[model samples]
Target: MISGSIVAIVTPMHADGSIDWEALSRLIDWHVEQGSDGIVAVGTTGESATLAMDEHKMFIKACVDQAAGRMTVIAGTGANSTSEAIELTEVAREVNADACLLVTPYYNKPTQEGLYQHFMAIADAVDIPQVLYNVPGRTACDMQNATTVRLAEHPNIVAIKDATGDVARGRELIEAVGDKLAVLSGDDATAMELMLAGGKGDISVTANVAPAAMKAMCDAAIAGDRAAAEAANAPLLMLHERLFVEANPIPVKWALAEMGMMENGIRLPMTPLSEGAQPQVREALRHAGLLK
Candidate 1:
């Protein structure tokens, strides 16, 4: 039941690549006002890869405290390491996050059985609702449908964020285990279609800039009102496609900054949005009516 437009929110930063705690608070408040069903703090879009361990822990705690039950705060605790993932999930649990999202082990390319053990290990270690994340494109690790269905048996494992963008396969996964767990779409461009096909909702990067529209689309889609969902999603189609014109968050963080929501302060290794891609991103926002 943890459904609807869950934003994989970016961690707002100062121009010097430092966390902008004040901006973070403001953004969370905006989502609450805009009707986002939930948020995944420190997720991939939040630049989790570069955060110090203490920063990561504090980031999740801050989001949870700020949200204050106005909306679901799902801590993004996934790591390439199982123990690290467990430790992060434990932190989420201690801080009272609604759920923790754990991506499949990356870089090591663990086998299917290895993937199973890795997730099962974490579910065993943490007594909290857990959501699986499978973005093979980013992780070079794909959790097959069978493995996901197998993991669904664990009472604590409640959902999976399917970023594969394959609606056909997503439908298969839903039919296989939709009764046991929610299959949330992790890819925004195809999220509405997947939801119409039975996805519970989306973990959206696009929602960072257009929460109300995304929430409206999700509300319609989840309610089986395809016409309404399509109308709500039409304006955001460009946002969904353009947000990734560069790498993630790069375009999205820039979009947010353009809207005067936050500073355009991306971390090193991930620089500010390039001058070339800026125009299209701007047009995307304009098309969505998020900007004039």
Candidate 2:
């Protein structure tokens, strides 16, 4: 299972926006040391849009190599195009990634049937494990319960990263197909609730800055310890809401830099956290005890 606090890691870049492999390796080591059970490189949080295909593949391969079996590495190999998605997934399998997180197609909104065929094509195309990423907020295309259940029948499509933040929908999906597939939360704000309601884990952005606390929350909730889970949840309560004050990786990347974990550099169109937005995010970090 791709369960627990899996950081949707940031792509550490130089001040000039170049990939910093040394920093990248250090970040990986830090996550594993902080007790992150998995690393999701080149996902949305990693600024995947700005990275070229080769760069994406290189990043994934490097993370897999660095992890070296210490933790699961789930490559973000999603594309709006079926053929492109298949190619990315194939490259992920070649790198020996444990699984691939395939997000819904963006820009080109597809019907439910199209969604099914798209994932079906990729699942059939690749022999490796596949986890469907249904982040309707990002893709503007939601994969309903039926579409997911249809794909769930495919053995290779093992799980889901549900970023919808709709607890009811998550519960329904779990009730309908929890036995067939693991439903992982992609949204941090509702991770604990989703877990209590039957989510397997979180594909978390907050985990990048506070892995231990986040992991503790997931572990407690999954173990049926509500009070302990809520106690662990206190520090994360702010992070659950503030990391998205602007756009993801903006506040998060800046938070990591504040903690001296990584450079705050971000690619074009997605700049660093706004000067105005810093104080609140910093306070959230302070509340979480990640910063002062």
Number of the predicted model whose lDDT against the real structure is largest: 1
**All candidates' TM-scores?**
0.99, 0.99
Model 1 residue 268 CA deviation (Å) reads 1.4
Please provide, for model 2 over 88-173, each residue's C-alpha lDDT reduced to its tens digit, 9 standing for 90 to 100: 99999999999999999998999999999999999999999999999988889999999998899999999999999999999999
Q: lDDT per model, in order?
A: 0.95, 0.92
**Candidate 2 lDDT score relative to the true structure:** 0.92
- Over 164-245, each residue of candidate 1 has an lDDT whose tens digit, in order, gives 9999999999999968999999999899989999999999999999999999999999888999999999999999999999
TM-score of 1: 0.99
Which segments of model 2 are wrong by more than 4 Å?
Answer: none
Clashing pairs for model 1 are none
Off by over 4 Å in 1: none
